[model samples]
Target: MWTIMMILLISLLIALFEVPYLRKNAMKREMLVFFILLVVATGLGIAESLEANIPNPLDWITFVYKPFSDFILGTVE
Candidate 1:
């Protein structure tokens, strides 16, 4: 889809501008972090394009906390 293309194109543009700078400065770790973040962003973009059911981290956090919160409220009441 156009969304994927745009995402990739923008990412490519960023690499085009940034990667060489990282290489010029011998920033190996920075380069690795950049690529890792780029790949993660791209994968999330593609998954979103396909409407994959990506689980929300907040939902898990809330699920894990809810019982404890209820217990506290029960004791407080």
Candidate 2:
């Protein structure tokens, strides 16, 4: 719970520090992208803190390539 709170607090601090520059410079697109990335990062951080089972990207790659690797080994043999 404290880890989740810390992640949110850090994200909030980042936004507080950055939002004004974006607003002052009229960077609407950048602001939109920033918020989107911040939300994604914060959600992932919270999920990790909660010990949620997030799938690794490499797992998917290994799954996809396992058959190809097996075929290559068979051909080499």
Candidate 3:
């Protein structure tokens, strides 16, 4: 899909710009963090592509905030 292509293209461009600096500076910590993030992102992407139901963090945030939002609306109106 075009969306995937665009994401890949942008990621490639970012890596092209950022990777040499990291390599030149011997930024081991930065490279480790980047690889960890890449693995997490790839796992999520595969789960989504497979249509597997996954609990999203946003759901938890909304669950926590819904009561406060309702209370605020009740008080304002």
Candidate 4:
């Protein structure tokens, strides 16, 4: 789809501009992190374009902490 193509093209453009500087400076770790973040962003963008129901990160945070919170509140009561 057009949205997917646009997402890829934008990511490619960002890499084109950034990758050479990273390579030229021998920044291996930064380059790796950059690629990882870029891939994650691109995948998220494509998923959004396709109208996928991406779960909010906060939901995971709340799920993880809810039990602890409940226990703490019970102790306080």
Candidate 5:
């Protein structure tokens, strides 16, 4: 899809512009972390563009706590 292509192109452009500087500076660990974050962010962007319902931490928290909240409210009432 065009969105995916655009994402990849942007990522590639960023790497092209940043990687040599990292390499020249010997920032191996920083580069590794940067690439990992970039891949994750790009994947999430693509998934969102595809209308995927990505589960968030808030969803898990609500699922775990909603029942407890209801029970406490019922007892108080």
Candidate 6:
């Protein structure tokens, strides 16, 4: 709870410090991308704090590659 709050507080401070420059300089696309990635990262952090089963990216990669690896090995044998 406290940790999540602190994390949000820190993120808020960072955005407060950085967003104005982006707004003033006409960096709308960069600003949008920044916030989008920030939201994703913050959500993942909160989920991790809650001990949620966040699936690993590597798991998907392994799932996709395992069959290919097995086929290659079978050909080698």
Alpha-carbon local distance difference test for all models: 0.91, 0.96, 0.76, 0.97, 0.91, 0.91
Q: Estimate the TM-score of every prediction.
A: 0.79, 0.78, 0.61, 0.85, 0.69, 0.87
Q: Could you tell me which residue pairs clash in candidate 2? A: none
lDDT, residue 44, candidate 5: 93
Clashing pairs in 5: none
lDDT for each residue of candidate 2 in 6-43, tens digit (9 for 90 to 100) = 99999999999999998999668899999999999999
Tell me how candidate 2 scores on lDDT: 0.96
- lDDT for each residue of candidate 4 in 1-77, tens digit (9 for 90 to 100): 99999999999999999998899995788999999999999999999999999999999999999999999999999
Task: Give the CA lDDT, 0 to 100, for residue 72 in model 6.
Answer: 100
> What TM-score would candidate 4 get against the native?
0.85
Query: Which residue pairs overlap in candidate 1's backbone?
Result: none
Candidate 6, 1-77: lDDT as tens digits: 99899879988988899898989985789999989988898889889989999999999999999999999999999
Candidate 5, superposed: residue stretches over 4 Å from native: 57-77
Instruction: Please provide, for model 1 over 1-77, each residue's C-alpha lDDT reduced to its tens digit, 9 standing for 90 to 100.
Output: 89889989988998899988889996688889989999998899889998999999999999999999999999999
Model 3 spans > 4 angstroms off: 1-21
RMSD to native, candidate 4: 1.4
Top candidate when judged by lDDT against the true structure: 4
Better of 4 and 6 by lDDT: 4
lDDT of 5 by residue, 52-73 (tens): 9998989899999999999999
How much does candidate 6 score in TM-score?
Answer: 0.87
Instruction: Identify the leading candidate in terms of TM-score.
Output: 6
Candidate 5 structure lDDT: 0.91
Backbone clash tally (model 5): 0
